[model samples]
Target chain A: MPFSISLTVNGVSRNVELDDPRVTLLDLLRERLDLPGTKKGCDRGQCGACTVLVDGRRVNSCLALALSHDGAEITTIEGVAQGDELHPVQAAFIAHDAFQCGFCTPGQIMSAIGLINEGQAGDDPERIREAMSGNLCRCAAYVGIVDAVIEAQKRLADAGRREAA
Target chain B: MKTFDYVRPATIAEAVAASAAPGAAYLASGTNLLDLMKVGAARPDRLIDITHIAGLDHIDWLADGGVRIGALVRNADLAHDPAFVRAYPAVAEALLSGASAQLRNAATGGGNLLQRTRCAYFGDPASACNKREPGSGCDALGGENRLHAVLGWSPSCIAVHPSDFCVPLVALDAVAEIEGRAGRREIPLESLYCLPGDAPQRETVLEPGDLIVALRLADPTAFARHARYLKLRERTSYAFAVVSAAAALAMEEGRIRQARLALGGVAAKPWRARAAEDILAGARPGETIFRRAAEAALADARPSGDNAYKIELARRIIVRALTLAAAGTPQRLPALPASPFSSAPGARHAA
Candidate 1:
């Protein structure tokens, strides 16, 4: 049965008609919404390349059924940057050379943002590395990824303190 | 993935009724179900989404110092719950050691309890697997049997339950609550999983249309306080355990009063080492006694050719876990190794 559902994607309302219920959130984001920034690496949840923020929690969109998350507030990589300014995590990824092929950069950035939001990514490099293990880098840029996450966490914290002050 | 009719029920009774329909399955987080569906292992004609059902998403503290975790409680929230962490650190540790952060955020309590094995042969439709297709011969019997079971396996199937949470739950003596058409009933968590006897297809004791309501832990005691979960995997993190142990001990004046031990990656289900527990009951907390207990635990272990190393590994991990539990030291995460992708010719180094 085809059902019409509405979702809040990247702070905007997205209403779509689903002919098939098995269409995954990753497919919907890429095909229906035309947001191809969230790459689908393995389609299974193991790769973490389809990671997106659903209700402020990081989840692999490839495993998520589109109909199951009808009203969820989803934030993909395409929404992370402003009109001109990139998110601190994205900026840090560039500064730290966190990618080789750039296919997994969006997912790595989203996962890093989730880590910072969960307050798990402290200044410690080991903690950051463990927390970011979900996002794999096939090009072995893990060193730069870890450094970027740690730096981004510090920068986010500093910004938070400034806003509070 | 095949196109299936999806229905989200707002009530438990409706969900149960929907589950009773022919070729119907209840979907929660879809961490495992979606993957299995994609691989054609599970082809349900109808999916009943139960994530919207209310009142099944809480972690309640019982009056008797026990904890009642709802069926819909996500693995990540359950692991990070302060009450669960403070009381049963081993449970939290076991959950953390199992899957990645993204998976833990989506996997629910009931889903984890009912998650299937990760046998490569079983996932492949063309391969001969009794679990995937009953009455078929087990291809893993002689083929690439490194990850096969070392204990509690029948000739039909040697696949082990790939869950880290079940190890600690069995050690803690937890109970599973189920709701069926008749009424609600409870059973020991260990009884929920069945041994892979002649009928390897029957994984759990859950009856048709029965929905797992919650998991309840009894009163927290000394065993809960002195507990440790040690998992050894192929890699430092984000990998399934090669062999793991969840050990808890209650001591009195340097003597063992009560002990609980469960082994993972060794059997069809979480293998509870009751014989080893008996050996450590009255013994002193020392290396010799721990070694004896570990030996007693593996006395009945029957390993395949390629996985014979698991016996020695399990023995060492059991002893190490018991020693750490006796000393009240929490297990530390192992350091990460350099990525295997780093050695590839096209891999780029960090600037």
Candidate 2:
């Protein structure tokens, strides 16, 4: 039996017709939605390579079934940039060389954005590293990733302060 | 993942009724269940999607200063709840210590309690795991069983419960409010899990279709002042504990009025050290006494496999956890959360 689910993907509301219930959110995005930016690393929750914001909270899309997340607002890597202007976290990743092969970059950037939104790490480098531990980089880009997150968090905070003032 | 029919239940009654059928399982965040499904460990024909069920996502404060946490409350939300963190700091710390930030954000309170063991043999469908298949004959007994349980394990299974949250909850005497086909009932969280005896397949005391609606925690303000969760993991973060302990002390006039201690990653359930707690009550807090309590806590612990070192590690952790708890919980959680290095004076700065 096909299940119908409504989702807002990258600010665009989508009413998807699922042919099978076995389709995970990751598969739904990559296979059906024509969005391939979200990499499937482990295809399990262990590796956060398939991370995306479901209803503004970072979750492993691989483990989430599409039908279960009906009406969820999803933010994938493709939506991170505004036109050609890269998101702060994405630009920071480039500046800090946070990727070697660039496989884990999308997930790392999404997770960083989520962490900044979470507001738990503050400007603490160790906290940022700990918070970002979910996304693994086989290329050993952790040093660069941690630095990038710390710098991006500061920039976001500064931008917010300026907007408020 | 196998194809299954997903039913979104609007209420608790509907959820129970839908889950009453064989091969039906309630779906929460799917952090654990979905992973298991991918590995062919859990194959449910029908999924009762209970996430949409109303009135099950609250964190209510009772009049008696206790708390009633709905089953649907996400792990991150509960851990970061300011009032909850203040009252049950150890529980918050334990919650923060387990899994990654993403898993915590999606995982629910009830799902945490019901998470299956992380034993490699049980996760591998080809392996002979009595827990996965009754009477399959335990292969973990001789095959890379270093991480097997050190206590409360039977010949049928040596797997340990992998929940970090349950360690402190069991220690603090949390109660589970369950809704079954018959009616609602509450039980001590400590008794919720059964030791993997002859029937390793039957993990929890929950019958089929029994839904854990909420978990009630009585007032723990006395222990709040000196409560801490200390975890010794393979890494600084995002790893399960090799050995963990939750210690809370209620002190009176420089003497311990009461103590609660529990160990994790050592048994089929969160191993509450009632003997250690008994030993600490009315006694002055000191290194010698703490060591005695640690010894008492591991009195019956014998390694199920080659991981005899875990017994010693569990003992040391008990003492260190008690010491940290006696010293007092930090004004705020450490940057590294429950890691042993977090307790070091300049660890965060050095990092």
Candidate 3:
């Protein structure tokens, strides 16, 4: 018999079947929930196509089992923005042309936002590059990825300053 | 991946109970195991997920000034620990140089130590890899063995250890605290990995019911202060190592008091360079000492095909690491300014 699990994903209470707790959260999202924004690349974790925010901390969804995350809040690419306004990361990515094929874009954006929120983002290019090491794009579009992150930080700071002014 | 029974135990005892079962494997972060399962390399009949066991993910101060890190502690947490950065920089640096942010956030201390080799032949489903199938003949012996072992290999298998963390732990003389059906005991990190003499099927000495619970690091030493880990990967990051070295040096008035060395990407297990250590002890730090130490370490090196580059590459990595360790410490900035293009990910030279 499959076990029943209760989870809060994208701020909604949900019930699911978990016969095999070894099924990665990525599998649950893409296979069961039909949220295909999380791509599966190198299913072995060599690539970061399946990044997601678990309780606001970015993790590789393909490596984390859905069962172990009971009661934890999860936010995917689907939950990043309001209905009309895109999140700053998404907007910056679009502005800077951060992606080519758009397969690994969601993961890269999620990771960058998580880093900025975690206070791991810094002005140094190396730390930014080092922290962004997990996400790989086949088109080798790292230059644009870094540019998008820097631009997002600047935009957020500018918005904060304007609101205070 | 084969369908298997799974349990997420809320308590350590329950997790251990599940892990004690025959054919049951304890799942930490599951970064490595899950990946292997997807490729049809590892299949466990039962997986006992221990990520929810809260207390097992702590880093406590030992009464003896050392640190006891829980097996389930995430790699990112350990890498950024202030005490680890101050005491054993090599270990902190090793953890930082591996995988990437998201993967390390999900990779556990136990899982990092037990990660499998990246021998291309071993991972390919069609190839004859003795590690995957015993007595199935190792095609890597006469095949495209660009990542095969240069040390601690036999006629059977030549797969290199792929971890960036275990290399430094071996040099530090760290120990593992494990609990299982047989109860709790500590083993040296050096003896944890087994060299493939003939039976390449076996990777570690871990029994069927053993579960790694903690890793205990020893007190800081002069050698630890001068330690460094340098990795040369295909694209500088994310990719596995083409050649890497974890080395520690002790110096007095330009004379080497003691030096410890270990090689990765060139060995079946993290190769402990006792010969190089002995040769460089109390020796001067210069081209002569570096050349001889490299020669002694690679004296028995056996490379195949395009991997011959690793012979020189591994030597250069060792020399560069040792040179930096002996040459000079980085100037302290007003604040911690992260390096932009460091040769190694975690070589923060300081007091």
- Please compute the TM-score of chain B alone for each predicted structure, in the order given: 0.93, 0.97, 0.91
Ranking by lDDT: 2, 1, 3
Please write out the lDDT profile of model 2 over residues B19-83, one tens digit for every residue: 87779999998999999999999999999999998889999999999999999999999999999
**Candidate 3 chain B worst ten-residue window by lDDT:** B331-340
Candidate 1 has what TM-score?
A: 0.95
Q: Tell me the spans in candidate 2 whose CA falls farther than 4 Å from its real position.
A: B344-351
Better of 1 and 2 by TM-score: 2
For candidate 1, write residues B96-125 as lDDT tens digits. Answer: 777888999889999999998998888888
Candidate 2: Cα lDDT at A128? 89
TM-score of each: 0.95, 0.98, 0.91
Instruction: Return the lDDT, model 3, position B79.
Output: 79
Q: Rank candidates by DockQ, best first.
A: 2, 1, 3
Model 2: lDDT of residue B277 = 98
Clashing pairs in 2: none
The residue-by-residue lDDT of candidate 1 on A1-165, one tens digit each, is: 688889999999989999889889999999999999999999999889999999999999999999999899999999989988999999999999999999888999999998889885478786677778888989989999988888898899999999999
State the DockQ, from 0 to 1, for candidate 2: 0.83
Listed for each candidate, the true contacts retained, as a fraction, are 0.75, 0.78, 0.71
Pairs that collide in candidate 1 are: none
- Model no. 1, DockQ: 0.68
